[model samples]
Target: MMQLSVAIGDYDRNRPLIDGRAKIDGVDPIVMTLTPEEMFFRAMRHEAFDICELSLSSHTLRTARGDAPYIAVPAFVSRAFRHTGIIVRADSGITEPSQLKGRRVGIPEWQLTANVWIRALLQDEYGVAPQDIQWVRGGLEEAGRVEKVKLDLPDGVRIEEIGATDTLRDMLADGRIDAFMGPRAPTTFVPSNKGLRWLFADPTAEAMAYYEKTKIFPIMHVIGIRKALAEQHPWLPMAVYKAFAQSKAIALEHLSETSATKITLPFVEEQLRRAISLMGRDFWPYGVGPNRHVLEYFTASHHRQSLSARMVAIEELFHPSTLETYVI
Candidate 1:
């Protein structure tokens, strides 16, 4: 059985396939799930692993900066999901991106891919350079654990490292921080519970503009195969991609149509139904067509940032086998 590692955080939206579910039909492959942070580091380090899902902004930037080996996922998959947003307390005085100045901001993990992307958004769209804001990073720091990388502060900004989501909620409730950037549900829901509001209901324009200029989207959660492994077993990529495709279809069907069929695990029918209602239609869908905007934005923003990297060609990332099968 071929071995691959995956990273599926708490969010069910992007959870990787597991159990027999992750297996590619007609081929034997075992898949393992890693924490998001670990997956990012391992992929960058180019450690032993067949397929890995990476963060588009933080992980891909490091790869572009020559820190890791080049790994690609199909372009179609990249297009489906793109963009991250900033979350703020409801009563805070911060209204626009400019208001973020001198405020403490909560990030899920410092130096993670999302943080990197948020920084890019601030720079490209908001004109708030990374060197200008206080960044608060979060993680679990209990006994027998290493202290995570604390956020680095720029001039006139202060950063504090805190552990626990409860701390973040408390901070927001007590006005300890001005805003946070994260996945939509957590960022919006948690803050709303504490009387916080999304600072920007729509943060996709800047990202969309970036995509219009460049073809490459900063890749997040890519399932990459090492050159040697792909060479050793040429069909592995196709098999894996197809399995993910099937899983994606299943997820979408679950969202659009309802049944007593008990599709998604642990999440009961009512709960899943509620989640679908909460997310609406565009939140999750099969394939990457929806996220094309993200790549376009990344390419344009990278150009502006002086990265000088070529726009990622669609063919460079995806193989014809998976593309054709899913494209129709």
Candidate 2:
């Protein structure tokens, strides 16, 4: 059996595979549990793992430039609605997305998947074009952060930088910036801070409404295999895909054991029921066919947002071997 190094998050779905409860056929995976930031950075910059959780935006950026180091399988490991991603200063008096016009918004990276979705929704849903606001790029909690992938945005998109030591939380808390948009919320979003709130008053409701309208859950991450390894071992992508799919299935099955809450938070069963009622039994699905609408919407937004050099076809995003699966 070949040993492959893998880097991914410590989510429940991935836990089973990491703990040997699940197995990839014909291969042994040496898994490393890391934060998304560390995983994406290493994967995007160094191709540091045999398989890793890749930022969808960053992956698309590289693929468009024709230098992608990894070949992806359609196992979406991370996804979120992103309505909650837009964090505004309470004192900014920004009541709606429309009010974002002429404001300065801070972001961690232009190549962030959450920002791509947030930016697209702002323009399409509320007419808040990307060029209308001044974009400030910096770290969310520290300093000296740069875009994960280089941006070649078209004209009219004005982006600037923060001070060497400045963070998005500090700028927004003190009102230096009108709002901050990224995958993670600023630490200032607390009762004591009283400075930040999501742009949407009820982000959950807004997300559900958007889902009902567009049927998109907003994919944030994809599993990527080293391109060289994939080319050499043609069966590897599907093997990895099936292992993740099986692990996710196990996690989902665990969600329905209502005798005791499987998760730390309360209302696990209740929320699960609500999600199933709204999104069907297979709400969080994997693979190309199940998530084509989401991929199409995201690819269109990515190109329109100018994060990609060209419009990335869904067909160009995944391994051909994993594109179609045999049905038994």
Lowest-scoring 10 consecutive residues by lDDT in candidate 2?
A: 187-196
> Model 2's lDDT to the true fold?
0.90
Model 1, range 113-159, lDDT digits (tens) per residue? 44555667677667887657777655322212222322223345445
Q: TM-score, each model?
A: 0.62, 0.98
Q: lDDT of each prediction vs. the true structure?
A: 0.54, 0.90
lDDT digits (tens) for residues 191-210 of candidate 2: 68777788899999999999
User: What stretches of model 2 exceed 4 Å from their correct place?
Assistant: none
Top TM-score hit:
2
C-alpha RMSD of each candidate structure in angstroms:
6.7, 0.9
